[model samples]
Structures are given as C-alpha cells and as structure tokens.
Target: DQQVKQNSPSLSVQEGRISILNCDYTNSMFDYFLWYKKYPAEGPTFLISISSIKDKNEDGRFTVFLNKSAKHLSLHIVPSQPGDSAVYFCAARPVGADGLTFGKGTHLIIQP
Candidate 1:
C-alpha cells in the first residue's frame, strides 16, 4: 500500500511554542519525503524535504526529520505563529516519480 498516515487530524499550539507533526508510511520503496503547508483556498507550498539517505533537513522556522528504519517522519515548526494556522500535509514518493502519496492532513492551529 502507498498510504502515508497522519494519525492526528489536528494539532494546536500557542504562539512562540514548538509545533510538531508526525507521519508514518508503510511503503519501504519511498525514498523521498516532503512536507507541504497550505492556507485556505490555496495549494500546498513545499516546506521541507529529506531524502531517505538523510535524516534531517531544515529551513528557516521549519525542520523535518526522517527515520528510515521506522518509516516515520516529523515536521517541527519553531516559535509558532497565528499565521501558521493551516493544514499541513506529509508526502512521500519513490525516487523517480516526483509524484507523491499524501496523508489526510493535519490542521495546525497556532493560538495567539
């Protein structure tokens, strides 16, 4: 199966705190992992990504960590802001497709 699972459909955090989102995949062939953030009525924007060969990747306020052995990955947002409130999707794909399998999504709320 190509399912990527985000068990929690939502998360809430206060501004200035850390926001962590978790995801799991059953497909061992997936070698590329990515996270995308979306605002209302807009397409998801790529946030961070890591290859199966790497364990971590970071960009500004975002960081992504992948554990190949467990087929798990996470996204961390530091100093969360109300502006960060939106849906986050975790995606993965095999090395060549460039196409992705996505989780249902997590609605992250950053409380002011």
Candidate 2:
C-alpha cells in the first residue's frame, strides 16, 4: 500500500495568487516531512521541510505545514508564478530512516 498519497492529481492557480497542495500519509513513524519541486526531465529539487516537532516551516515564497494528529501536510506557495509551475511532491521519513516515502505528486499550473 502507498504510504503517502496526493488525492488531487493537479491544481490550477492564477499568477500572483496563492497555491495550496495537500498530502496525506499512513505512517506515523515518519518524523520528518519534506516538499520537493520537480521540472520535467530534471530530478526533484529540495523545497521545504518540517520536523515532527514543528507544525510549520517556511522559506521565502514557500511554506510547509505538518499536522501529526491528522497525518496530513500541505504546501503553500504565495504569489504563485508561472516559473513556479511544476510537479510538487510530499515526502516523509523516519528520524533515522534512510529512504523517503513520496506522494504521487500534484501538478500545479500557474495561469497568467
């Protein structure tokens, strides 16, 4: 069974607006959560991360929220832009785990 899942296959947003992407996981052992942005053909690049102890983490225009009780997390992009258009994936790992569990990913389109 998939440990992490992205219920929405895609999302659309107007440029300069806010974009929200959500993910859910089944593993409570996951103590670290991360978001990765990917462009076609290129490998996913690190975006943001949140520790299990924290409910939120932010970087520049990107923010990540974690809700351990709900086993859920979300990524927020403020002032979404065309350049920010990409596949966003949610991933999680245990405190000492080597590999990460990733959601299928949500395709985001920033409409001009």
Record all residue pairs in model 2 with backbone atoms less than 3 Å apart, i.e. clashing: none
lDDT of 2 by residue, 14-82 (tens): 999999999999988999999999999999999999999999998999999888899999999998999
Tell me the whole-model lDDT of each prediction, alpha carbons only: 0.93, 0.95
**Candidate 2 — worst ten consecutive residues by lDDT sum?**
88-97
**Candidate 1 C-alpha lDDT tens digits along 1-112:** 5379999999999999999999999988899999999999999998888989899998999999999888999999998999899999999997677679999999999988
Model 1 error, position 22 (Å): 0.4
Cand. 1 Cα-lDDT: 0.93
Segments of candidate 1 deviating more than 4 angstroms: none
| Over 4 Å off, model 2 | none
TM accuracy, model 2: 0.97
